[model samples]
Target: MHDAPLLPVSRRQMLATSGAGFGMLGLASVLDQNSVHAAAPVAPAVSVATANPLAAKAPHHTPKAKRVIFLFMNGGPSHVDTFDPKPELAKQAGKKGPGGKWMPTPFKFANQGQSGI
Candidate 1:
């Protein structure tokens, strides 16, 4: 039977494995304190057991919007031409504006969904 040589663990290796656990412990203490303080004077103790430090909670009142979608257009096509089509502006295409001539959108607009806006 061949015996394998054991290598010594470095400081960096030890920290990398255990650093996250230390960070989590620190985070938990901060969250516990914040939850206790954030609760109302009458129900201060309730928050310690009921409050979730990480989970998302609903607002005090029901929100009109259930979900939201954000579009981040960076160094691409124009948003007005692509998503929000202005039919009135299309009619006045090539017309002289206050600054310069109004340029028309190359793409055609078509209704897609039942709630067409």
Candidate 2:
């Protein structure tokens, strides 16, 4: 048996295959223009003396606290064991619970700061 000869792709076939990519580019441009025009007007920019963006600016209204920092620990230390120490948990350690016996925290906490968490 003889094998059939492979045919080369024509310019029309190539253009047809690539038409979707060109269409997507055109659609993206149109969507971007619509979004730009239809979007809400930007608020007037706050005038700053310094070039640095990190430089602190005066709040519109007086804030109770001057600054705030948020710490997010994903799959980190348990809150009860670390921040909120429970002495009763130590006494009830090794006691059976809903699933298994309760385990005590290894770290010992002490009163430190003036606030004393």
Candidate 3:
């Protein structure tokens, strides 16, 4: 018996079919039970010391600051005083800046607290 000749496949049709076929093949290999790249079995540590798995661990390193004060001061005293203190801008008071004239901060910038950070 003579073997049947293959049909002429267009580049567009071949690419479309082959892309799907390759994707399916890759998915099948990944989903296979006896795959070489299978995930390792996740076994929990069954130790007496680590009985409570949900327990919090000790700090890796002692923090420099004891208390953290997160002040979200938008166009407030903290923003003007602590963070962005424009001394030059203060000197050039009423002078023409980017948008308008440079207005100096009312509150003076000084080291208040013990550790003035």
Candidate 4:
């Protein structure tokens, strides 16, 4: 018989392919009786531990920074009264907030030889 020209697969063409499932496995089992009757005696049974395609593994190295601390204050207190104060902040506290609203300083500042916030 002469070879026929191969036809190209077109976008409009529809395919009807039925896959082999458990029924095909059953058929394979029925038609595979010869495999059970081996001519030579079998060797000792080996463990069937196949390599896992998706298995959990340990990380390569130790991680640092076990904790994260964030202290959020809506309107922070006066700098000088609380911690290291800057005289410039007290000089311009109510003048204008960080976002432009005139937010008064929560606490008072003073001149401790070093100008207070």
As for TM-score, the candidate ahead, 1 or 4, is 1
**Decreasing TM-score order of the candidates:** 2, 1, 3, 4
lDDT for each residue of candidate 3 in 6-113, tens digit (9 for 90 to 100):
999999999998999999998898788467677776776775338876777777998789889998766655543656567787789998989999888797777768
Question: What residue pairs are clashing in model 4?
Answer: none
In the predicted model 3, the residue pairs found to clash are none
Q: Write the number of the candidate with greater lDDT, choosing between 3 and 4.
A: 3
Q: Write the per-residue lDDT of candidate 4 for residues 58-110, one digit (tens) a residue.
A: 56887687998998878876754556544577577667566895544476546
User: lDDT of each model, Cα atoms only?
Assistant: 0.80, 0.82, 0.78, 0.60
RMSD of each: 16.0, 16.9, 16.6, 20.6
| lDDT by residue for model 1 (1-117), tens | 999999899999999989999999999988976795665547466564367676576679978997999998778877554688778878988999998988877888788888584
Collision pairs in model 2: none
- What tens digits encode model 2's per-residue C-alpha lDDT throughout 3-90? 9999899999999999999999999988986795666757647645455678788779977996899997789777655777778889
Query: What is the lDDT for 56 in model 1?
Result: 72
Task: Order candidates by lDDT, high to low.
Answer: 2, 1, 3, 4
lDDT score of model 3?
A: 0.78
Task: State which candidate, 2 or 3, has the greater lDDT.
Answer: 2
TM-score of 2: 0.35
> Candidate 4 local accuracy as lDDT?
0.60
- How accurate locally is residue 22 in candidate 4, as Cα lDDT from 0 to 100? 58
